[model samples]
Target chain A: MNNHVFRPLYLALAIVALVFLARYLLVPKDFGAHERGYMYGWHRKGNENEWKAVTVKYKTSAYCKECHDDKVAGISSSSHRFIACENCHGPALGHPEDPMKLNVDTRRELCLRCHAFLPYPSSGRSAIRGIDPEVHYPGKQCSMCHNPHNPRIPTSRS
Target chain B: MNRREFLKNSITVIAGLAVPLSALEFINPKELLADKPGGEKVRWIFLVDTQKCVGCGLCVMACKAENELPYDADVSRTWVERYVVTRDGNTLIDSPKEGRDGYTSQKITMGDGTSRNVRPEDIEKAFFVPKLCNQCENPACVQVCPLGATYQTQDGVVLVDRKMCMGCGYCIMACPYAARFFHPVYRTAEKCTFCYHRITKGMKTACVDACSFDARRIGNLRDPNDPVTKTIMSGRIGVLREEYGTKPQVYYLGLSREVK
Candidate 1:
């Protein structure tokens, strides 16, 4: 019942009341709208405009067909129809406008990426004809025997 | 005590109780904004056909390129782990450059400072296991995050709210898969988002698109027509570290017992 003891306790209670009042006014009504659990609105403070939106960089193969109809037609009808041009050619960042010739990787290793036979059990989805790069053509580049865009050998080019 | 003093004490106690009780009522906001009224809730699932993966490392490179993560061991968003078990009870595990560079048959130095040449024929069995955030339905990262910076979407994708994250590193420690990491540049805890940006826009993830062997696929588990749905229902699928009880959305087709 001492006045001195009650003074500091009253001030502490008043400060706590003010803090709650400030939180009530400041926190968004739908602070934890997207989340579920006890600490839902823990991120509501100081995160109003926080999402970092990214632009799409790796576009679909359909994007390439718009400009190069001839190449698209060639690839579409060939044995390599499922393969996207960018897969072999890399990302098409700056193309016809910049007039930069995309590096046509003619290395045998490029073709062997998919065609090299692995000893593991195939899932039947990836049971495409694979060859040992060493025995198939000693030092010959894959492009020398098979066209990259069409991928069929000269015997099956038609 | 006098009646006047007794009444004053009762008033003080009533006021103290009312203040905190009223404050608790204001804490939880009402559901003013309803999430799209009748939109179907999407349940995403990622499938990995381990047999189809030829250790090509294209998916690893594609994930790095798409996320714009630096080409560093500690910073990779996703990586491929090659497990080579030899006939003589020797198991070799390596993920050079986080498997960003395709693996080659070469001499690998062991922990004992001894070198061994690994040839294709000498090994009893070898397989490539690609690893990324499991995006668990019951994600520990989401649960342990001190700040609600990490959350799982209704569609089952776990994401990090970069701005909200306090870089506490608690979520990184909580994750059983070792998927989450403190990003060096952003200084925020970062992990695989299941390509949430692309998946929401009806596009396959960068890894799925880049894989030529159909090694990886993602689809709506609710849609019966999706081929991936059939693969999930029928295939002998297994998840990584199911004992942790995370209930990961990602499933592997030919998961061997050796893979952790």
Candidate 2:
């Protein structure tokens, strides 16, 4: 092909590549103010059009203590209370709206939902450890073998 | 200013900053942002005297409150597994059929192996083991993480990074004592961190502080005056699964021959 004929095509290709790169360079991550989809910015879901885009303001475990003084204080004294509620339970949209109504049928199901695969800030394992949901924990719930509140798992060694 | 010059300058600046920023995010990441304190670690461990556990189930309460677990027919996060190991070292575990809250019932087991009821006296010659996270020195959960999810702290406390954890249950199986439990919403593997956040911040573990008989103890194994170590060193302490080699930091003092 003639150099003159091919010059415009070459320029067009370069412009397209540059535009793609520029878009990648300019776009910041788009996350909602109330809700966080995944691990990095996990939070409760809220109206996308209703609220402005802002960093999700995570409430502390203590914030939960304000209304749940007894439960929070109990949790504070308990070993598991050290962990925030949302940390274990996920960022619930409105837990305080009706805490009593909140239900996780299987004891292990709630915990294993996160801890079995996803870990805390100081995890001891990886992201995807490949645990079979159905067969892994059978009739015996997680508490049968371990305790959420206790730092030590109970045993019959002695 | 020319467009080419602006693009070149901005790209160079952003590229330089992005690499450093991402690196920092990975290095000093926040475990929790809400009312959280510095995560600098001090040593943490749990010491249980099986002889002291009376099966009252206070640690169970501690677990429920701490983890905010729901109740009913499901399993309790930290339930007391009470049973009598036979003369042959075979265990016969007997737990309350009811979840956390249940009425006192009679001892009646269906011969067909369905649901049964048992009174306190029916549990003859029984010992209770309150199991939770072992907080091992070499945790398999931390080793097997695919996304750098669960990690060990500087002071040797093992815990999950819920944000990083994908809720895969490999850590649950890797744990020989079945110490790990899954989080319901976050969908990650979790277990006892020896109350890592609190213990490191000058607070007692939930179960330890709540225990009436002092059955649960937390202390630095390295400390000479640490009562937990002294108690274990003084008495014949038994570490579970000396064969699995998880190097569990939890030590059991006063192991009975029946349990062996």
Candidate 3:
């Protein structure tokens, strides 16, 4: 062909090369249309590892059983067997090392979450024993009269 | 050949090559192109017993503590709503502080000026329904994310890529359940992940562990011995917004007709 055809072809090839080079530089190395789908699957493979590496803040009661078998056994035998120790004591992710102690939430509001009477017969909440907070010891703390570990047995003040 | 005919044929060949080459550049050849997103070894499912929920906000508090969210912030990853139906067939709904504080009063203030006390005798029914991210099989949040910041894991949990997210609100608006919210601190779109960090370590989600009433449970569908899986297989279950067809993984037991 003459120089006329060759000129246009060379210009097109140069533009294509420029676009490809820009894309290589702009797009992240880890970016991909993953196995999920082409339309919505764009993601960085490194993100999965980041998410998996996130620190877990809450530990189940099983973790507490290792050291505090007495408290674990006490709760397991009581009506509060299902309750995890961390629920009332706060998250024990960094216990005995950093803080050395867990704060026990003895607030009346904490206990009232389950004990407050709603009178909803349809709801299974009524199945659990509830007391009328208004009439049942207005200002006194529940822990003063009742031991949380074994709620059935009232705490005997020494 | 004529210059025009030669030019047209050459352009066609170049265009065909360009399309596939660009596509190949974006798609990694080494990655397995599976028909499904996750493997068959694990499929996580969440079950909520609405009957057992007592409007206790422990789960909300636990989620905040576990996720390191601002405790005083209005937005939360999970919340509980109270629904009260009167004998007159009027439905009333309220979620005071997202039920972060348990419902202290039986009285609900009217839209006007007055407050009506929902006594057991006057009210036909009252119940609490906890709400959280559905972690849908076909997630709308993932579909609408412009940057693909939101994605579902192989085990069926949906997570946000905080580094990838550019604080765009597209996924927040696209969510049918209003499960996603802008993080007050990070300023990125955030939602529930079913405690992916804890779950992968063989521990319960913070919310599930906080629920002393046995209101929430998570299970793997692949495990025959999983209690939550057994309950799902044998019990009557329901999901919210079935019309949306998001195929939400969270199932509700004893779901009332009034709940949305």
Candidate 4:
């Protein structure tokens, strides 16, 4: 064998060995141990702390039932049963302990958030019986005629 | 051996060695993770009923509050685009601040730098389309990520490994939906995760929970009992940018042809 050819071949072999050596030492021992993928260990490593830091900012509707059982019972039987209390009042982060006062948003805009009719075509079940905010009520509030919890007012015809 | 024969033999040996090295790169962690004793395999799918969406932007607000994403246009994980197609075959699309403040009838500036007043009767048709990371079966973002920082989980959710991310922004460029963004605070690539924390804990996503109209839904596609599966089976659902062949999990119902 020619010395020049053997020399370059040996150099290549040495470089390959060095690269493997570096990889073995520098890479984490648990790297790819889970067989999740190339990025599994990386994902776990990155998100472990994040998972721990996740604070429960929004509590379930059951949380509100503990204190406001009466209010819960009133709303549960109404058409708004699916609607969470926090959905309208905002996130009750420190309500029980700090007693964070929540605003009773009675503004027409607040009521119209879900009640306002969209002009676009929609299914009968999904469609909200929307009213022209200006024309329907004129100057009176919606709550004056219809209850916030149960909006369906009994008509004289019925 | 002749010079040509020697050269061919050398090339053959090199190519043989290269094949296995490249193959090793394709060893997915999710497959291994699935093999664990207590592992639960979940296939997540997001469904959007466009007919039910009233453009209230509550989903956008919910996502922001849930993810604690900064109030920056460049960092929104999800947003809503309002499309108004006029009688003259002109379409106007606008999404102000990712529809965070909710949409009101306003004068919209068109793509051609022309301002038009969008009235109720003047428009032929209008609808709101919510946008988010599709969590594609074959994601371009994951493919372009150089450091293996982005990966899909066994549940089929695409997520970025923040610790491993070098913030090269290649994934951002590769994403056709413009879903990925560089988080100014984290200084790394960030996008929607389908509310991984909430979903893993057996809870609905913030957007799904907030939507009063039942527009947005998330369910396990593998589960036969899931209601969303029924919706998928019956509805004329569509995925955005189907031509790209991303095979996105997010399904849309009542998607207008004018929708991009």
Q: For residues B1-260, write the lDDT of model 3, one tens digit per residue.
A: 99999999999999888886543332111121122434555677889999888877889989998988999998889999888898889898877667787765676656575667777886788888989998877788898888878887766678888988998799999889999999999999999988888888787888998888888988887676778877877788888887676777788999988988
DockQ, each predicted model: 0.18, 0.02, 0.41, 0.22
Index of the highest-lDDT prediction: 3
Candidate 2, A58-119: lDDT as tens digits: 23455556776776665566555545554444333355673434443345544443333311
Q: List the residue pairs that clash in candidate 4.
A: A35-B29, A36-B28, A36-B29, A36-B30, A37-B28, A37-B29
Query: lDDT score of model 4?
Result: 0.73
Better of 3 and 4 by DockQ: 3
Q: Please give the range of 10 consecutive residues that has the lowest summed lDDT in model 2 chain A.
A: A118-127
> Over the stretch B177-243, how does candidate 4's per-residue lDDT look in tens digits?
9999988778889989888888878878888887777889998776656788667766678888876
Candidate 1 runs further than 4 Å off: A21-30, A33-35, A39-52, A77-80, A93-146, A152-158, B1-40, B72-74, B106-115
Ranking by DockQ: 3, 4, 1, 2
lDDT scores in order: 0.71, 0.52, 0.81, 0.73
Top candidate, metric TM-score: 3
> Rank by TM-score, descending?
3, 1, 4, 2
Writing each residue's lDDT as its tens digit, candidate 1 over B142-180 gives 888876777766566777877667799999999999998
Q: Give stretches of model 4 more than 4 Å off.
A: A1-29, A33-53, A77-79, A98-112, A115-118, A122-147, A151-158, B1-40, B72-74, B109-115
Query: What docking class should model 4 receive?
Result: incorrect
| Superior candidate under TM-score, 3 versus 4 | 3
Error of 2 at B50 (Å): 1.6
Top candidate on DockQ is: 3
